[model samples]
Structures are given as C-alpha cells and as structure tokens.
Target: MTVESRRLDGNAAAGRLADVFAFDATVARTRCGGCGTTAPLGAHHVYADAPGMVVRCLVCEAVVLRIVRTPGHTWLDMSGTAALDIPDGDPS
Candidate 1:
C-alpha cells in the first residue's frame, strides 16, 4: 500500500476516503494483534492526531489498526478485511 505523505486535515481526509469508498460511515473495530481478539472501539479522544487515529483493543491496546476507505469499499489495512466490493463508475 502506498502511503501518501501529503498532509490532510482529519475531517477532509476522512471525507475523501468515504467518498472514494462510497461508505455512509466508517466503523471502528479494535483487535489484539497477538491474541487476535476483537472488540468494538470508539473514536479516540483526539482523533485528529496520528496516535488518536489508531483503533486499539478494549481489553488490551496491543494491536492498533487504521481504517481507510478504498475506491470500492471500506477496508482495514491491518486485517485485510473489506466491507464490500464496489465496481468503478463508468466515465461515459
């Protein structure tokens, strides 16, 4: 995955991602990288920051994941889970 260094405000970046992925909203899920346990997660206290952007396990903040939007659907870069597959729109 190509990580763009260009900086974008959290809201704008999230909006762009949502538009790209065609998702109404992004869900947050935290999982333990070691144990593979997952749990519901909430927005960080300061989501605009990099550390705040992480999704950590409720029981153990061992695993941190970031959810990003794709052209077709939402995806978790860490777990490689895609919410849905969307076809590209025709330009014609």
Candidate 2:
C-alpha cells in the first residue's frame, strides 16, 4: 500500500495513546535510532491505520515505536528509539 494510505501525524494515534502514557506523549522527545535526530514525538509519522500504531522518525522514516494491544495485554516496542525523554511536570 502507498504511504499516504496508512500514515498520519502522531495525533492520530491518540485514540489509544492514553493507554500508553499518562501525560501528553505528543510533547515528549525521542531520538531516532536510525538517524540520531531528536524531535518531539508529535513531529513523527504515525500509522494508526495498521493493526497497531507505528511511530516513525521524520528525518529517517525509521520506525521509532510500535504499540499493539491484545485482549488482556498491551505491547510496546521501542527498538527504533535510541532515547526517550519525557520531561517533568509543568515548571509553572
């Protein structure tokens, strides 16, 4: 299938995204394993149309993360992420 048919911005993964993170994961920073580029997770490509959510790096188009859910388990694969930086709460 073509890239457009299954790809979307990270926001599209929000449907089940809450199940993975308690905070707004979109603002989180992640370093792409393939290209070593660091960017907010929201800037990546999310293919939610697939069986699970596939988050790819914007610079290298490499799979950064994958989240799949089953009846009683939620699976997450971050093999493509070299580093994940989830900041602390509001500094306000």
Candidate 3:
C-alpha cells in the first residue's frame, strides 16, 4: 500500500498505548532497528485504523512497532525496534 494509506498520527495510538504504558507513549523515544534512526514516537508513522496498530519508521518505511489486542490480552511486537525509552515520569 502507499504511504498515504498507512498514514496516521501518533495521537491515534493513545488508547492502544494506554494498555501498556503509564505515560503518554507518543512522547517516548525509540530507536528504529530497520534504519537505526532514533526519534520521538510522535514522529513515527502510526496506523491505528487497521486490524491492529502499526508504527513505521519515517526514514525507511519499515515497521517499528505493532500492537494487537486479543480478547484475553494485548500483544505488542517490537521486532523492528532496537530500543524504546519510556521516560520515568515524576517520582511521585
């Protein structure tokens, strides 16, 4: 599919990310394994209208993350990501 077909912003991932992250994941930092590029989640291309949520690398157009929710649990695939740094919000 074309890039336009896969175009969705990070905000669309909020609900899906809420299941696994405590803070706003759109603001997190991640390293793309495909391109070895690091960028904020908001900068990644997020497709949430599909059967599952998919996050792609802007540089290489490779999938950097995916989330699939099952009736019993949620599955997250980060095979395309080298590292993900979720900030340790306020220590309160």
TM for every model, in the order presented, reads 0.33, 0.86, 0.83
Runs of candidate 2 with Cα error greater than 4 angstroms are none
**Model 1, 1-92: lDDT tens per residue?**
22333332224335534544454323434344545554333331113345324443434344344555446666554452222223345559
Please rank every candidate by lDDT, starting with the best: 2, 3, 1
Candidate 2 on 1-92: residue-level lDDT in tens? 89776678877766566787997788789999999999988889998867888999988899999999999999999999999898897989
Cα error of candidate 3 at position 86, Å? 2.3
lDDT of each: 0.39, 0.86, 0.85
- Residue 91 displacement in candidate 2 (angstroms): 4.8
Which candidate comes out best when scored by lDDT? Answer: 2
Worst 10 residues of 3 by lDDT: 3-12
lDDT of 3 by residue, 35-78 (tens): 89998787888877688889889788799889999899999998
Steric overlap count per candidate: 0, 0, 0
Give me the runs in candidate 3 sitting further than 4 Å from their true place.
1-6
Alpha-carbon RMSD of each model: 10.7, 1.9, 2.4
Model 1: ten consecutive residues of lowest lDDT: 39-48
